[model samples]
Every structure is written in C-alpha cells, then in structure tokens.
Target: MKRIRSPQKTAEKLLLAVMTLFAAVASVIFLLPTVLTITNSFMAQSEINANYGVVFSSVSGGSKTFISEKVNLKFIPDIVSFSQYFSVLFKTPDYLLKFWNSVILTVPVVIFQTAVALFASYGFARLTGKLKEILFFFYIVLMLMPYQVTLVPNYLVADKLGLLNTRWAIILPGIFSPFAVFLLTKAMKRIPKTYFEAAMLDGASELQIFTNICFPMVRSAVFSVLMLVFIDYWNMVEQPLILLNDEQMHPLSIFLSKINTGDTGLAFAVAVIYMTPSLLMFLYGEEYLVEGITYSGGIKG
Candidate 1:
C-alpha cells in the first residue's frame, strides 16, 4: 500500500531537512580549527611554510597581514611527512619529560579531588541542617568565584608551606576544588533517602552503604568529575606558570606555550599528541558526563 503525504506534512519535512543541513554546516565551521590543526600536523615542512609563513612572518615584524596577502589554508598535505612526529617523540627528550610531568600533575588532582568531592557530597546529602546549608551556600559562592580571584591567596599559602616550585603547589589547590564539591553534591542529592533507610535497616554501616550503594548509583557523576578535573588540569597554564619558577619543572601545557616560532611543524605535532589524553577521556566519558549533568541539574528535594 502507498500513502500520499499531505502538503503540510511535506512542508514540515522540507523545513526539517533545511534545519539539519544548516546545523551540519555550522558544526563543520566550528570544527574547522581542530580539523586543520590535526591535518596540518602531518604536513610537510615546505607546505606548512607555504601556507602559514606569512602569518608567522608578520608576527616577527614582517608586513604580511590577512588583508595584505592571499590566505591559503591546507587540510591535506601535498606530501605527508612523519618527521615532526619523530622529532617530538624521539629527538626531544624534554618533551617526553614534560608530558610525563603533565600526567603526574593531572592524575593526582583527578583522583584526590573526585574522592574528596564524592565523600563530601555524600555527607552533605545525608546531613541536613542550617550549618550545612550555610556551608553549602559558601561552597556555591566559592565555585562561582573566578580562579584568578583565588590565585594570589593560593600562591601565599603555597609560599608559606614552602611548596612553591614543587608539584604540591599545583596538587594541593586542585585537590579541594569547589566546583567538584558543587557538582557531586548536586548529583548526590538526586539520590533518594529511602535507599539509605533501606540499607540501614539491613545493618549496613555508613561506609558500607556509601561504598556499596551510593558510589555505584553516582558512578556517572564520578566519571563526569574525573573527566572535568582531568581536562581542567591537563590544559592548565597559569598554575604552573605562577607556582613553578623552574622551566624544567613545567608541564606540557607550559611547554607548548614556549614552542619556538620557527618550529611550527613540531608545534602542530605536539599539539595533536598533547590533545590526545583529554580527547580520549572526553570520548569515553561523554555519555556519563551528559547523564550526570542532567541528573544534577534536575529538581531535587
């Protein structure tokens, strides 16, 4: 049997098609930079210079401008080269060292902060009172405050503790992040109290209940926290810059910032490699992130 669509239904379908096409175009426009960075990483040195030499030259006091010269953007290389990748991986020992430094600096923050947030959020969810309300309000206020606002106080504390220039200067401040507490607390509140009551009736201790029940229930939120924390710390520039005086001790984020203007090919390669960890975490944790945020943002008692 064949069914004919009404004119109105056909018009609505055409509208949907147009909207989808518009969105696809918009997405491609937004993703262009990332796509170009990744593709340019494999470009031959000559091709890179041919494409971007004018811009870099302008930065170095040449007279080339976007309006002054014909701009050429390259997504595919005339001849793909792995020299940049090899240089970053083998020829540069410090790049690997700084990459590991980023790993060391980021992993502890993610683990400790998520653990601290989860436990603190569990306590806030279970206990209800005016004092708790006041404290939670403070947490929200602190979370709203900009990172730059706290940077000076944090530096003073680090200086006082003699942790300046050491990884502790970075780790300590990140471990007690307010945003984690706020996010995880919201997730925890969404959990019903009846679950806690049932667990208690079954003689489950607070630790047992937290470990056995609450943690599993909020696994997505935990993953969300880990992803967020990792990305935040992985791309950190200011903390390392302000806290660590020694360039050798800097993370890859700071290292990337110091990339030589002449080494554009190496810079692009490093950028791609540097972006991989956060990319992987985001891809894997994306579903958890969405679900966690949805639950956290919903109305709760």
Candidate 2:
C-alpha cells in the first residue's frame, strides 16, 4: 500500500526544506569573505597586486578615483606562496609589536571582566529588592546605549584619571563593562532556587555556595562571556586610537587600516593572523556558547 502524506504535513515538510536551503545559502554568503581572505592571503604579492592593484591604486595629484577595471576575484591562486606570512611574522618587527599590543590589551580585559561579572552577577541573582532591580535595569540601559555615545565621556574620564595615552584607558573600561554582567546574571537566575536551598541547608557559606553551586552551574555562561569579551576587545579600534596618542602604543587593529592602504598583500595576511585568535576561541567554545545561550531554568539531573 502506498502511504500518502496529509496536505498539512506536506506543507510543513516543504517549509522545512525551504528554510534549510535558505540557511545553507546564507551561511555560505556570510563565510564568503573569510574564505576569500584566507585563500588570497596565500597568493604571491605580485599576483595579489596584479589582481587587486587597480582597486587600491590612487589617481594622480593625490586624489581618489572610481575603479575603471573589474577586479579579478580568484578563489584558488595560480601559485601559493607564504611570503606574506613570512614578512608579517619574521620580516616585520612593527607588525609583531602591534600584534603583541593587541594581546596585551585584550587578555587582561577578558580575564578580569569575567571575574568582576561573575561576582556582580551572583549578587544580582541572589538579591531581591526594588533597589537590586533598579540597579540591574541601569546596567541594561548602559549596555543598550551605543559605545559611541559614551566614548566622549570615557575619554574625559580617562583624561582626568591620567589614563589617557596608556593601556589602562582601554583595559579599565573593558574590565567593568556591563554586557557580561547582564548575560551572567540572567544565566545565574536560571539556576533553580532549590539548589541554593540545598546548599544553605548543608551550612554552605555564601562564598562556598557561590564557588561550588552557582559557579559550576553557570560555567558554560562564563565561557560564553569570555569568548564574547575577548572578541570585542580584540577588534577594538576607536578606544586605542583616541586614548593612546602614541602611535607605537596602538594595537594591530589600529594599524590595519594603514596597512590596507599601503600594502594590500600584507593586509590579507595580517587579517588572517588577526582573525586566528577569535576563530580558535569560537571553535573551541562553540558548544558551550550555544548551551549557555539556550539553556533554560532547569537543573540537569
């Protein structure tokens, strides 16, 4: 006997297929630039210049002109070369310095910001009062506000504190950022009150309960926040550019634009290197990130 699908079931299956196809296409579209950069980074500089020189070339008399020639967008290089990476890694000291500067500025922010958010989130999760709600609301407001809106104030405050022109200007604000607090607080709140009750009945002190119960339950959320905060600070441009007047103090992100204009070939290689940390972090923490985000208020048995 032939099995027949109901009209409603057939429609649902069709919709699912359509959505899946759309998602696949969207994913490829999103990944296209990353794929292009990685592949093109391996092309020899002469080949890169031959392919993209027209796009980057300036008109005479120091003026910009629209590209008259179509750019050759090659996915596979005729010849692969490591010269660009070699130059960025070994031949150039400035590139390495800026890369280290990015690391120096980003690592401390990720570590300390996660620490501060964990404690602050625990407070928000456990406390119950109009005051706590009001304060948490303020944090949401600050998080919602565009960083550009607060950049000027941050500048003024950093100037007053004599942190301008120093790495502290970038690190301090990032360490106390409210985004992680907002996320971790929500995650901690999702943990059942029964767990806390059990801990309290066991004579667990606040610190002990926080460390053993809350922290363990919210571990995935912590990883998610760390990955997020790392990505945010790793790609920071405006903060360092505005706060640090010393060109040498600027992170690689600040130098990326200049590199793009001057050495297009180097830009591709540097961009790949710049992307590596965030990419690796994401790949490693992807499962935790999804679990942390989608987890509901239920304790796993």
Candidate 3:
C-alpha cells in the first residue's frame, strides 16, 4: 500500500535535504581554491600568466594599433613543467630542510601533548578535590585565551629559563596544552563510574585501571586531540618567528616564509608539500574524531 507522507514529515525531510545541499555547496566553495592551487602548482608559471596575455595579447608590429589582429602567443609557453617543485627542493635546499624541520618539530609535540592530556583527562574524570576544579578551570581559561596574549610572557619565561634558541623552546611549551586536557576531560567524565568501581573491586591498581579501562574507553578522544594538535602546530608561523631568533633554530613554519620571499611559485609548492602530513592524518582519523566527539559529548550529557 502506498501512503502519503504527513505534512510534518514532508517538511522535516525537505529541511534535511536543504541542509545537506547547503553543506555540500559550502564544502565545494571552500575546497575549490585549494584544488585550483594544487592544479596550478603542476603548471609552469608562464601558463599561470597566460590569461594576462589574453588581454594584452597582440603582436605590435611597427606600432600599428591593431586590436582586431590575432596575435601569436609569444608569452604563452608550450609546456607545463615541474620546475617549481624542483626549485623548491634543489635550487633552494632550504625548502627541503625547512619541510623536514616542520616534521621534526610537530611529531613530538603531538605525542606528548596527547600522552599528558589523556592522563589529565582521566584525572579530571576520576579525581576529587577543590584543587582539580580550580586547575581544570585554569586550563579552560588559558586554552580559550588568545595565542598572542601568551606569546610575550612565554618568550620572556623561556629566555629566563635559558631554553631560548633551541628546539625544546618550541617543543616543551607545546607538550602542556590546556585545550586537549579540557576536551578529553569532558569526554572521559562521561564514562560510567561503575566501570572504574568494578575494576577497583576486582583488585586493579589505579595505574592498571587507567591503562586497561579508561584508555580503551576514551580512545576516540585521545586520537582526536592528537590530530588537532598536530595540525595546529604543523602549520604554525608566528610563534617560532617571535621566540626563536636563531636562523638554524627556526622551524619550517618560518623557513617557508623565507622561501616565499625568494619565490612565489616555490612558496605555493612548499605549502602543497607541507600540507600533506596534516591532510593524511585528517583523512585517516576523521572516523575516530567523529566517534570520539559523539562519545565525549554524549558520555556526560
């Protein structure tokens, strides 16, 4: 039997369709420029300027004003080349070194930030005291604060501590993020208390309880934090510029800026190169993040 959908149900379905269409259109609009950049990177710079020729494109033979005459495209190159990519790596070896430097700097920051954040989250969920409340509140406030506000004080502190001009200058500070702790804590607190109580009654130590039960349960959250933090620092620029004055100590974020000054084409190529790690991580771990956010959000509410 065929039955017509009620007006309310029809309206709900229409709204969903409109929402989905909006999302897809928004995504395409955002992604279109990135796609163009990638495609244009494969093109030689001459081709990129071919459009300019289309406007001014005329063989000015002996100063005859001929807008009607079809001009041979002298500026238009016959071929697209990977010259930009080659220049980014070889002609300027700094691009390559900077690319690797970004990798070195970002990897450890993600690791330890995730490690400490997971434990902190567990603590927030499990522990009791006025101290925990105060500390967690402090973390949320700091995390929510602007990065620029913290930069000067952090630099001064690093200078005082003599950690300036070293990789540790950037890395050690990144290891102790408050946002990761806050988000994970929110996720972990959602886990049922009975699980922990049951584990304890069965003779598990606190350490054993965290490793066996808490970790597996909040796996989604930990993974999400790791991905987010990695991408955040991976694309950093301003921090290393302000804090680390030494040319060698400059992470790839600053290094990319230097290349940009030398060559625009090479700069875009570097952007394309530098984006791969974060892009791969995002694509791979999106499922984990979705599950983690849903789990974390619903765990308590």
Candidate 4:
C-alpha cells in the first residue's frame, strides 16, 4: 500500500524548508560585501562614483551631520573595465612593491612555523612522560594569551635584540607561534605507537620514521596548518604597524586600510587581487582541512 506522509511529517518538512531558506538568506548577507567588491572591480569609474558618491562627499562645515539618506550597494557592473587593474599594476609602482612585501613576509612565516611545529609535535608525541603533558599545557596557555598581552613583551625582546624595524622582528615571533605547535602536537599524538615499534624493528632512525611514516600520516594536518598560518600572516597588520616604523617596509595589508575614498575602483581591484592567493590556497587545501578535522584522533585503540 502506498502510504501518505502524516501531518506531523508534513509540518516537519515545512519547518526544515523555512530554516533552509533562512540560512541561505543569512549566507547571502554575509557574502554580499565580497560579492560587491569583486563585481565593482570591473565597474566603470562613473558607475562607482554614482553608487558611492554620497558616502565620500566631503562636508566641510561646522558640526556637519554625516548621515546618508540613501545607500547604494552595487553587485553588477554597468560596463566591464580593466582600468583599475592597470592603474594598480602600471600606474602605481608602490602598490607592486607592497604586494611583494606581503609575499615575502607571509611565505617565510608559514614555511618556518610549520617546520618548527612539525619537529616540536614529533617530540611531544613520541616522548612519553608527564613532563610532556606539562610542557604542552604551557603551550596551550601561551596560545590562549591574546596578542595584546604578548605585544609589549615581544617589543621589549625585539628592541633588546636590535631586530626592530626589520623583517626578523615579525618572522622570529611568528616562527615560534604556540597555536601551530598545539595543533600539530594534537594531530601527531593521535598516531599509533605501534607504527614506531614496527619501524624500529627495521633499524629506522627517528628522522627516517618521522619522514616516511609520521609525515604521510599527518599530511592533512600539515595542510591545515599551512592554510591557517598563511591566512593569519597574510592579513597581519598590527605586527608590522608596531614593529616597522618605516611605511615603505609595510606589507600590502597595512596599505589596504589606508586607501582613501577617491580610490574606490582601485580599492575594489586591489581587494580582488589581494584575495586571490588566499582563495587559491583555500580551494586547494579545503579537502585536507576537512580531512584533518575528521580524522583527528581517529586511530584510537
């Protein structure tokens, strides 16, 4: 007999549809700004001016009330143009230099931090003792401490070491990030101890076992760490602001914040360009990110 769904089931389905629609709306709202930025990057100067003119107009008077009666949010370009991109690439040489500065600053931090974390994690996971637990607890505490708490101490150390206003000022602190160590250690500890025992039987050295066995097992975790560390460093502004007094040495992230209202199109173009590396990184490693989360501590005896 073909049975129809009960009224309760029908009501549950209707409620699910409503919740789904709400979630979709919320997602669209969250992503609207990014969407607008990308679309407006291709918009003509006239269109951008037309849309955002009210917000940018200078009210040079006593006690001026800054209130916009109408706000325009544009998602579609009137005419596709590459003028903004050209302006960024060719018209301004400083922007290119700052872009390179970001690359230089971000890449090394990600690589070195991940490497340090990998080795530290191996030691933590393999070394069996209560001392290891105590050390890891300290790492967690350090990781939990906010940047503001550490900033002054880091500044003191950097000044003492004469590393202020240099790339080393930023790189050194980043290379020893506690969060990376914590995450990598957690993943590495999940690895089976039996693997080490088997590898030892073949006279495999610790380094060899780590490279051939531990690394492959924690590949997803490594990818996750890379993506996270890259993103964090890529968007870093405060460290550079405090560490480097010279504006010329600043990364693209700091410059983006200082962009004025007149350079709306240029801002959009720069934004789109800025997001490309992160977007690409996320796309490539998203699967590993999911895998890392899912398979963490999966090999339980």
Candidate 5:
C-alpha cells in the first residue's frame, strides 16, 4: 500500500520550495546588472547609444523632469562589435593610464594592509589584559564607522602631513584600516591555547610559533583578508577624487564617471576592464574566502 505523507512534512516541503524559489529570484535580480554590463560592453557604440540614449540624454541635458521613456534593455546586440574594446584597449592611452593608477594605488594598500593586520592581529590574540580588550574594542568601533564619517578626518590628516594630491594620502589610511585587524584577531583567538603552550614547552620562540603554527592555521583567513582588501581599494573612487587634485593621477574608478559624459559605450568597455582584476581574484579565492570567514566566526564547516 502507498503511504501518505504527514501534514507537517508536506508543509515543511512547501516551505523549502518557497524559500528556494525566492533565493533563485533574488540571485537573478542581483546578477542582472553585471550580466547587462558584460553584454552591453560588446555592443557597437551606435547600438549602445540607440538602446540607452533616452536615459543618458536626459541626464546630460540636465532635465529636472522624471524620465518616462522606456529604455531598451537589450541583452543581445544585433551586431557584436569589438570596436569598443579595441578603442578602450588600444586607442585610449588615458584609459590605460588611469587603470594603472588604480593598480598602483590599490596594490600597495592590499599588500601593506594585510602585512600590518597579520602582526597587529597576532598581538591582540596573544596578549590578554583590560588594555588589550579596550584597544580591540576601539578597533571594532573604527571598523563599524562608515567611511564617510572618517573621510573628513582623513582629509585633515592628509593635509596636515602635506600628503594631499598624492597617492600616499589614500594609501596610508587604507594600510591602517581596522577591518582586517578585527577579522584576523577573531580568527587567531579561536586557535586553542594548547597549541601555543605546546610550542613554548618545546622551546619554540614567539616568532617561531607565529610563523610555523599561527600562520599556517590562519593562512586561509589571511588570503580572505587580502582578496577583500584588494577589492575594497580597487573600487575606490571617493578617496582618489578627494585626495588627488590632478585629474591624470585619478584612478579608473573616478575616470569611469568621466567616460560616461563622453562615449557611453566606452564607459561599459572600461568598466569591464576595471572589474576584471576583482572578478579574477574573487573566483580564484572564493573557496578560501568562504572557509576563512566560517572558521574565523567559530562556525564549523
């Protein structure tokens, strides 16, 4: 005889189905813009203009009226052209320069920030006292504060140090950001005290334990912090815009807005190039990122 399912089991199954459907829909919604950008980047300039002219025209024209025009959100172009890419990659030296500027400014921040966080986190993890707790609390507070709130202080400090209009203005602040410190400290603290005690008992110095034991255990978290910090600085626009006075020194993130004022198609092409580094980094480190975050939070995976 066929067995009947219980009402509770059926209800649970129904709930699961609903949740899955919601997740799928949300994923699509979130990914739609990225899909659109990648697809539109391949479209010919004429076609891009035809599809988006209504929206851009309104903005450029400085119209105060609400845009009632329906934009043609085409995922596929009638003709796929490489001209935009060709122009952005070859013809536009300025675009390439700005791209390099972004790389120059972002790379140092990622490298130094991770290095600083590693040592600082180690101290916070190993040391125990009211002072350590208080200091860690302050780091958390700084991390929690929105960047906007800290922008003025950064600006003032940069000016006082005569770092205004320089890459150092942005790099210095990012290098000392508290986000990585807080994350790494949490991850390090989760390591059992027995590991350190055993290492010490065996005549391992603090530096040796840090390098051989602590570093190995938290390697995934370090990778996670590197990727996260790289992505954060790579997309920075406000910092460069405010700090660097010379337009030529501004990163691609800032230049992207300027591209919109000119060739709208070029904006899409440049955006694809701009995001390529971040996308590649994320794809490569995705597994490490997830594992790091999981273990750091004391969650078993």
Candidate 6:
C-alpha cells in the first residue's frame, strides 16, 4: 500500500507555480524599460546608432560593419565610461548649479511647510471654535484645487509682494499646504484628549504641550507629510517656469526643460541625477510614510 495524495493538493500546487512564474515575468516587463535606458546611456554613439543587424567595427574611420554575433544587451562595451555623466556634470555649468538651487529651495519648503502644517493641524484637531472648522474647510478646498487655477493668484500675490524671480515665490506658497493640514490634523486627533488635559493640569502651556507632548506622539505623521512636500517641491517645473524669470534662480526641474532639445543624453543624465535625492529620501523614510497612513487615517482612523 502507498500513501495517497489528494487531487485538490495537486491542483493547489500547480496554481501556485503558475502564479509565481507570472509574477516573475511581470516584474521583468516593468523593470525592462528603466534597465534598457540606463544600459543604453553607457553605449558609445556608434553603438547607439548601430543598425540592429549591422555590427560596426570599433576602430575609428573603419570599413563597412558586419553583424556576426547577436549584440549582448547586458554588457554594453569593453569599458563602461562615465563620459555622459562627466559632460553633464562638468560641461554644463550654470545648468548644473540649478541642482543646488533646487536643494536649497526644497529644504526650506520642507521645514517651513511641515512646521506650519503641524501647528495648523493642532488648531483644527484640539482647539474648540467654529472659526477653526471654517478655516479647515477653506484649506481643504484650496488644496483640492488644480495647480493651474491657483497659479495665477499665487503669481499675483508673489508679484505684489515682490517675490517674483526669487525662490520665495515657490518656497513661501509651498509652506502652506491644505493637504498637510488635513493629514496632520487627523493624526493629532487620534491622540487621546486625556493626554492634553493631563498636560494642562500640570500647568503646561499650549506651546509646551505641542512641543513636548503632541510632537512626540505624531512623529510618524510628520514623516509622511515631509515625504509629500519633498516630492512636490523637488519636481517643481511649472511654478519656477512661471514665477522666476532669472535663469540662475530656476530649479533643476525648470532648467532641465530648457536644454531638453539640443541633447537628449544630457537631459536623461540630469533627470537621473535630479531624481536621486527624492528617491533616496523616500526609500529610507518609506516605513514612516506608510506607517502614518495606517495609524492616523481611515479604518483605524
């Protein structure tokens, strides 16, 4: 007599194997575009323009090329040189400086917006008043509005305030986000009122309660808001394009568009470099961004 196996068990194992193979194929299909772009960037101009079937001689001023072997996409050339990175990083002078400008502009925006949103959120969360509800509603409306509608008003105010052609045109507006207020206020509300009352009983001022008590309680929410703010301002193209006329003040996002036509390679290189900081920041802070959504909003919210 032999041990018996159920047909159901066999079916389940077969299903799982098919699903796993499908997932692996899906992953490769999605990543193939990015992988190809990065790989192609390292290929020499000759290789880039090389006929799909024609294999060219590497020697300069050589005779007609022949395609004998399938060109391996994995390993591009004998040596992968940094010529593209070097030219984009060095040959482009003022355009490259736009990177630092973006950094400076974004750092201030993140700090100021996060701070303002935290306080505004505290008001909407804890303070008792009809005005608070009204103000909160207004912020929600403004936040939900499209960027195009808001751009004109923002430009006018920036102009009247003499913020045009300056970093402030972008930074100042970014500092006050309704989305941040909405997210953070919900986070703050989740904290039990008992803590606030307890702090008040101990003669703690609102500032003290906010700094010492409330701040610690909602640390994860802050990270979530910071992530959004960083991405929004870091990729800013329209605002800088409209607000700042000075080439020097334009952020990398705006500057990248300027040189896009002449050389596609440099644009790709700059874009790859420009997107690095936001990627690194989010990768490291992903846990907190994800944690805040769960702990503070919807379902458990």
Q: In TM-score terms, which candidate is top?
A: 2
TM-score of each: 0.90, 0.96, 0.84, 0.92, 0.94, 0.79
RMSD, model 5, all Cα superposed? 2.0
Return the TM-score for candidate 4, rounded to 2 decimals: 0.92
Ranking by TM-score, best first?
2, 5, 4, 1, 3, 6
Tens-place lDDT digits, model 6, residues 154-266:
99999999999998888888888678888999999888888889999999999999999888878888999889888988888888889989878888887776554445446
Q: After superposition, how far is residue 93 of candidate 4 from its true place, in Å?
A: 1.1
Off by over 4 Å in 4: 4-16, 59-67, 297-301
Candidate 3 wrong stretches, greater than 4 Å: 1-5, 51-80, 258-261, 297-301
Best candidate, lDDT-wise?
Answer: 2
Writing each residue's lDDT as its tens digit, candidate 5 over 105-208 gives 99999999999999999999999899999999999999999898999999999999999999899999999999999999999998889999999999999999
The list of candidate 1 runs beyond 4 A from truth reads 1-15, 58-67, 297-301
TM-score of 6: 0.79
The CA-based lDDT of model 5 is what? 0.90
Candidate 1 structure quality by residue, lDDT tens digits, 160-215: 99999999999998999888999988887887788899999999999999999888
On a 0 to 100 scale, what is the lDDT of residue 153 in model 4?
95
Candidate 2 regions with alpha-carbon error over 4 angstroms? 60-63, 296-301
Choose 2 or 5, whichever is better by lDDT: 2
**Window of ten residues with lowest summed lDDT in model 5:** 58-67
Give lDDT tens digits, candidate 2, residues 1-301.
Answer: 9998899999999999999999999999999999999999999999999999888787677565778898999999999999999999999889999999999999999999999999999999999999999999999999999889999999999999999999999999999999999999999998889989998999999999999999988888898898889989999988998899999999998898888667888999999999999999999899998888777223665
Model 1 scores worst on lDDT over the 10 consecutive residues at: 58-67
Scored against the true structure, residue 203 in model 4 reaches a CA lDDT of 100
Candidate 2 residue pairs that clash: none
Comparing 5 with 6 on lDDT, the higher-scoring candidate is 5
lDDT of each: 0.88, 0.91, 0.78, 0.88, 0.90, 0.79
How displaced is residue 218 in candidate 1, in Å? 0.4
